[model samples]
Target chain A: MESHSGIAAVVKKTLNRRYRAERRFRRIGLAAVAVGLLFLAVLFTAIVSKGYTAFQQTHVLLDVYVDPDVVHVGNLDSADYQGLIKASLRELFPDVKGHRDKRNLYKLVSSGAGSILRQKVLEDTSLIGRRIQIWVPADDDVDMVIKGHVDRSLPESQRRLNNKSLAWVDALKEQGRLEKRWNLTFFTAGDSREPELAGIWGATVGSFYTLLITLSLSFPLGTAAAVYLEEFAPRNRWTDLLEVNINNLAAVPSIVFGLLGLAVFLNFFGLPRSSPLVGGLVLTLMTLPTIIIAGRAALQSVPPSIRDAALAVGASKMQAVFHHVLPLALPGMLTGTIIGMARALGETAPLLMVGMVAFIVDIPRGFTDAATALPVQIFLWADSPERAFVEKTSAAIMVLLGFLILMNGAAVFLRNRYERRW
Target chain B: MTTVGEIRAANPRMTCRQVNVYYGDKHAIKNVSIDIGRNEVLAMIGPSGCGKSTFLRCLNRMNDTIEGCRVTGTITLDGQDIYDPDLDVVLLRAQVGMVFQKPNPFPKSIYDNIAYGPKIHGLARTRSELDQIVETSLQKAGLWDEVKDRLKHPGTGLSGGQQQRLCIARAIAVSPEVILMDEPCSALDPIATARIEDLIHELREQYTIVIVTHSMQQAARVSQRTAFFHMGDLIEVGPTDRIFTRPRHSLTEDYITGRFG
Candidate 1:
């Protein structure tokens, strides 16, 4: 009886220990999941908060008399309109109690605002005859103050704009002279010297064209190569070597493809500098390895029995692959393609090597035209010394992240929709 | 009980003359010679790794898909050398189709699965003609009445036995003169296995059939001639009743009476 009781006690102790261990494991697993979720939440919150301020901008509204005499000067050469706009802006705020220095007053308007007004005048010469009230984008300091990026309590040495400028800005706000338009120009305009006026529309267009080129080139080439390798090619030493190279290519760093593109496309062939065509070519090389690897895996997932069934019916190997195997592998292939394209979309290093880092203010007209991608624009903005550019950089990053999430979501959706169980 | 010589005299559709198969350094098939008559069923029975299935794959050059597997000596169909390098493998396969151990229907509609072979070989030029071929193939496989109403459904959605019958229809759709089955009922339950056995008997009337079966009773019930393979060698080939009742090779006799594999 004593021995049996001792044995029963040990068994109960062991069972209790096992239960405790299981509970500990469950707690640790839940904790890990919570940690992962918290990390993602923090990253999203940080990005949205820092980036949201970029969309709103400050502007100075002025009803300036065109003064046909000043604009025309000696003749309507369209050149005099630029000086007239600058003179009008100076006259509008003459009696304002801001920094009385002429140079500081010039700082309130963006460095490139004169050129923007001149371009508008050049596009339409009839505007020279009328007195138009225009709301031009204010400089970065005024923009920061309106967006709450500026602190009025900071000393003049530490502050980006002085107290005198702040007083003038407050007076303008009180009189309803200062305005905050919907920033339609921020959507329509391209990159600018002032972060307050810079926009992503140009880079967005560039990304669109670059992806168009990448998709057009990579899909057919990658799928065809995969089909030939997986189906038609005989099992021989040369084909084996080819397969090894293809696998190795998939593992190679994407930046290496950029260097290769720099050497071959830009140097050897002399393609247009900083063009989406070159960026597309570089991205294609980077994406090819991914697409081919994915395509081959998709192709291999198709059972050999399907091929046999097709051939048993007198279908040739080509027919078997195209009609049967290709269809089955398509979902996987498309998922791979979308994933590869998303990778290309986020890539900045390769584009930098191919000169896509150049500042391109005009939107890309075609694949051959010079262009700057979103990430490259972000990089450029981040490197600027202007404090306002920091927010703009974060905003661009937000847009890029949004695109990546959308593309990956599409990949997951396609996988679930077309994935075959067999 | 008839001897191999007697079966050959009856009607030889496919004659294998001392065929050997090698996988790299391994001799997978020894000098195994047999004759399969037209419109008859021949079952090759053996323990696992005895080359019964390998021999069946050789009938249609299905073994070619396996790397390092080499076939030697002559296999003839109607006195024509099948191993000739110039012989078109696709056409050879069309002449001698195969049904795998597991049901491997194409991920397509049941009608498309049956129509695929005929469509690829240009057996049907029009939609109506292809439909006729699909119907006849299904009818031949004994699946017409059950599936005719839902022919557009995916072939993979069927039960295991139905999928196997669909594979049989897919093979027959090509109108091959010979059909090789490799353990075609191994994955099915007893009822499905019995249904497949019945289909095999019905199929023998139109094409020469060679089946690899693990079940001795299935062999005895379906085959007219049974070839027993031991260690990759054809130990005996004679009437099924003779191989089961009378002893020729000691190994064949031992295998039949369950002395040892």
Candidate 2:
């Protein structure tokens, strides 16, 4: 009796220790998950705070008197457009003088401002003789001063924009000439070497073109591969080998796909460099394994009895797959495809190898044109030494994240709208 | 329950001789032979994995879908060799339609589910004709009144028994000569099972039904003839009444009397 009681006490202690260990393990797991979520929150918050400022831009409204002699209709392209904006700024602040002060005054407007002045005269030829009011984008350094990003108390040697540039920005601000406007041009215009004139239009359009080709190529080919492999293929050592190879293909590093594209698509095929078509072709290879694997899983998840029911109703094998099985599996396939495409959208390395990392200034008009995708745009911006490019990079990240969210939301909606429980 | 000497109905619609099924190296069904009479309810009662469901799938060549599953020997329907290479499996399935163990209605509307088979087979030439086929099929399955107003609603929203009946209605919409039911009531409650049994009785007047069942009482109640299968072999087959009252085979008698399966 005494031994039995002792044994019971020992068992109870051991069980208590086991329970404590279990609790500790559970808590550790929960803490790990919490840490993961915390990192994501921190990352997103950091990107958003840095990027939000880029969405609004500073502009300087100028009333430049365009003398016809300065820019005749015949020589409109060769106008001293920068001198016109400089003269306007000089008139606004007549107290400033000398070559140094005059150069500082010209720095107030965007380097692209001269180009804008020329565009204004060319658009309405009558403006060449008239006093035209126009809004010109401010230079990035001067614009930073107006937006309170520049420290005025800092030594002139330590600052990117000196007191001379700050003085002109202050003059514009006092006269209600400098205003912050929603940056529509960022969405409409193409890439530029000047920070203020650079926009996401080129990269966004390139993304669209690449994705168009990626989706068009991957969906049908992936679905067909999945159906044939799952439904029709005979089981043998060779098929088993094929299955293993397919899974391995999915796990292969994406950069390797880029290299393959570099060799086969660009070098061997002699396709156009920096084309969305080649970028898409590379991404298609990277995306196919994901789609095919997910599509097969989607096809597998559908109960075999559904196929049997269709077959029992006299549906041909093709009819059974197309009419019954495909519809049932479509939601899963669509979600997988979207996720794969979203991953492709954020992929930079494969696109980089296919020469999609070029400084493309024009929005890709077609699949065969030179273009830079969004992630490559972010990469390029992040590499730039300019202070404004920091905001541009983060803003590009925000856009990329937004697109991913949209794709996931679309996936969820498709799944919910068409999914059947049974 | 007892099994008398083997019995044969007057007009056999399907005749199977030495049918064998193999799933890889596993011999799933041995040489099993049976006759399914025209427009009569034939019940196959067995314990699980006795190949009754497999044999039912054989009727429409539905076994062809399973990977590594091989079927050998002859199965004829209405004096036609169904395994003929030139024979269209699609047309054969239209004639020998099947109901699954679990009710599987398509993700489509009730009207569309019923219309699918007819539309695929080109049985309906016009809109009204297609509507008429759906109506009569639902009526024949005894689900018309309950679902008449909700024909456009998804078939999955129906109750369990209603869904099974909807599946039945879908099969009949194809105008099949034979309908194979593989444990159609195993998944249903007693009340639903009883409703399905009643449906089978009424359907026997028009289409031939071969139901694989696990319930002895269900077999006794619905089937005109019962075939007992054990370990991949047909042990006994006879009139359902005689099979219950005077089973000749010891194993058959043991299985039906609740001694042991």
- The candidate scoring highest on lDDT is 2
Residue B75 lDDT in candidate 1: 91
Error of 1 at A31 (Å): 3.0
TM-scores across all candidates? 0.92, 0.93
Query: Which residue runs of candidate 1 sit more than 4 Å off their true CA positions?
Result: A1-22, A71-103, A111-132, A236-241, B1-9
Write model 1 residue lDDT over B22-116, tens digit each, in one string. 99999988876777899889989989999999989898887887888999988988887889988888898899989999999988899988887
Q: Write the per-residue lDDT of candidate 2 for residues A1-422, one digit (tens) a residue.
A: 56988999999999999999999999999999999999999999999999988888899999898977788867888879888888888888898889987887888789888888999788889887788888999988876776678777889999987777776777778989999888887788778888899999999999999999999999999999999988778878988898999899999999999999999999999999899999999999999999999999999999887888889899998899999888789899999999999999999999989999999898899999999999999999999988888888899899999999999999999889887665
Task: Write out fnat for all predictions, comma-separated.
Answer: 0.80, 0.93
For model 1, what is the error of residue A421's alpha carbon versus the real structure, in angstroms, after optimal superposition? 1.5
Supply the global lDDT for candidate 1: 0.84
**What is the iRMS for every candidate structure?**
1.6, 0.8
Q: Ten consecutive residues with minimal summed lDDT in candidate 2 chain A? A: A142-151
TM-score of 2: 0.93
Error at A339, model 1, angstroms? 1.0
Docking band of candidate 2: medium
Compute the TM-score of each model's chain A versus the native chain A and list the values. 0.88, 0.92
- Please give the distance, in angstroms, between residue A24's alpha carbon in candidate 2 and its true position after superposition: 5.8
